[model samples]
Target: MRELVFALDYEPGCNTVADALAEHPAARVRSLSLHATADRLWRVDHVTGTHEALDAIEDAFLTSDYYADCLATEDCGATQTTRVLDRADNTLVLYSDWERTPACDSVPHIAQDNLGDGVLFETRHEGRHYTWRLIHSGEGDVAAFFDDLAGAVGESAGMEVLRTADTTASMRGSNGTQSSPSPEQEAALRAAVEHGYYESPREVDVAELAEHLDVPRSTLTYRLRRAEEQLAKQYVAGRLVTDEASISR
Candidate 1:
């Protein structure tokens, strides 16, 4: 199988969720589970932020006609449902299941048409960026999906292809799962390290690094920060597991 990673940038009014995120820069959402068919799409999302940010997101989900870029133009036995499964201090687990009509256009619907079944999708939403990682077969399907997705998005948002690579065993974790650091994040992190941005006396700053990567300064900074967070979490998790094993022994 091959893995295709890409990002979507939504204009202020193009996507309700993106709008809310732009308003609440501290909020973020990650897909826990996602599956899409031509007629329906369902996913469980984990959101984290301040109370105000969570409220904004809930309002957007409940009142908006479309989720993300899935615009519903016709109603043919279509239904949308959202439920908050869990809510804590600053985190919320939300489950959403929305039926797609013939006139609606969505990433999932496009994927179904081009990539077929058994395709895996992972998504993360922060600020105005929607990042997607898809794992599937068929080299031709990747191009098809990208073309269709771009057309569907049209002038509503910008799209960027981050990476495409064969799914090798080394890409997986010790427990046989996808590893941390997405393709985009990895690229940003590697660039910073190579440019001595992390050195005691930094040779390059974020602005310089951003210029080198040909991305906005804000975008480059966000990627590096997120990459650092992911790596730190993985390191802590690994250390905890080792300590547990030693205690058991």
Candidate 2:
């Protein structure tokens, strides 16, 4: 099995979210996750910048031609629901349960058709460009997949494969342990630490770190937090194992 990460760029107004993001230079969609629950039901998570941008994004979704219906949205700052639709903050994490139209021509649909069951894990919008990470089983020709996708989107779409790698053995550690963060998470953590994110003076802020990583600020923040949590858990588990061994001795 093989894992591939794809970075794709789309034209302006390609979809409602992309169009809304294009209008706000300071606010971008940091990351998005899509899960198809049923025939047309999909749960989507969108991490966006700025409350104003979130409002615009919500508007786009409500009026999008791709989704047949917007099932529901949680009001912002509400702790009751998993959806955060009305968040009036600098960075907003919006969750929506909706249904896609049968004839949807969104990027997700295009990717699903061309990439075969690949997971659209991460996406970031910056300066009218969209970068996406797709992971799928390596059972087909990568070149052929790219060709088909490019042809489907056309030359004007600016489709570029920024990076690709085979991550089949990435889960296994040298000690046969499986307690490491993902490559992307590790990279984010390493960059954050190297930039003095944890320093007393704080040499680098989240915004700077995001810029350095070439990702949205919210994306970096989410990665760093997750990586730290994972590492902390691993450390605690290791210490507990050592203590148990000493007690037995």
Candidate 3:
């Protein structure tokens, strides 16, 4: 359950940890700049290296732009040799507060998993700790995961404090559950707010907003359309338009 955002333009630097993770052909790192849920947040995810190779990965995230705005959460599997890393270790892990560990299993989840490495999995949350799975690789992946998680937690804390520090955090999950945006979405909204796009005059085009969001305008439109339909149904039922209006359309 570790997550956060980093430079979309990121490349492995000459750092020791980065060097090692780069050595592994199987190592995979995917960085996504997504729209934040509920509060408009930004998040990044990295997967790479053995436990011995993570010091470099940690270094990269600690210095990334999102680090200043996030608080990471860390969860080392039972066998973790390193004592749990705290938030100060990395703030990018903050994007992970939304995950939950599933019940134990017997079979290998990742068929290609190396025997020497025990699998570790952590769920992620974008808004209020929703459920998304990042399955385990092996013992080799542990160190980086823990380090990444610590960063994730710290980042999450920082974000929560910035946007909702004065307000209580809760998810309205009743069918009344509104669109729960991920941390990525929240980040874009912040940018728009700073740029004066989220204004009464409608300063920013929806497409511009989507570009700033790194998401398709169609996707955002669809989501908003759905949200509007739902809200209209729930809050504006029989008031805004009637069944006769639907027939007219």
Q: Which of the numbered candidates is closest to the native, going by highest TM-score?
A: 1
Query: Which is the leading candidate under lDDT?
Result: 1
lDDT of 2 at 138: 61
- TM-score of every model versus the real structure: 0.73, 0.51, 0.21
RMSD of 2: 9.0
Ranking by lDDT: 1, 2, 3
Clashing residue pair totals per candidate (backbone < 3 A): 0, 2, 63
lDDT of 1: 0.80
Between which residue pairs do clashes occur in model 1?
Answer: none
Question: What is the TM-score ranking, best to worst?
Answer: 1, 2, 3
* Native-to-model Cα distance after best TM-score fit, residue 67 in candidate 1, in Å: 0.9
Instruction: Write candidate 3's Cα lDDT for 1-249 as tens digits.
Output: 222221211123322222333443333333332222222233445444444334445554443432212231222121111121333322322232121123211112221122223322222222121222233322344344434443433332221211111111223322443444444445555666676765889788767877877654433443344344555555654444466697899
Off by over 4 Å in 3: 1-172, 175-180, 223-249
When summed lDDT is taken over every stretch of 10 residues in candidate 3, the lowest stretch is: 159-168
Candidate 2 TM-score versus the reference: 0.51
Model 2 per-residue lDDT tens digits across residues 1-249: 555544444455554565676677567665555553323434445555776777877677565534222211212121112355545566666665544544333344444555556444566655445666666676556776676666645633556454465554534432234356767778998898899999998999988998999875545665676578777767777888899999999
Alpha carbon lDDT at 20, candidate 2 = 78
Model 3 Cα shift for residue 198 (angstroms): 2.7
Model 3's TM-score against the true structure: 0.21
> Higher TM-score: candidate 1 or 3?
1
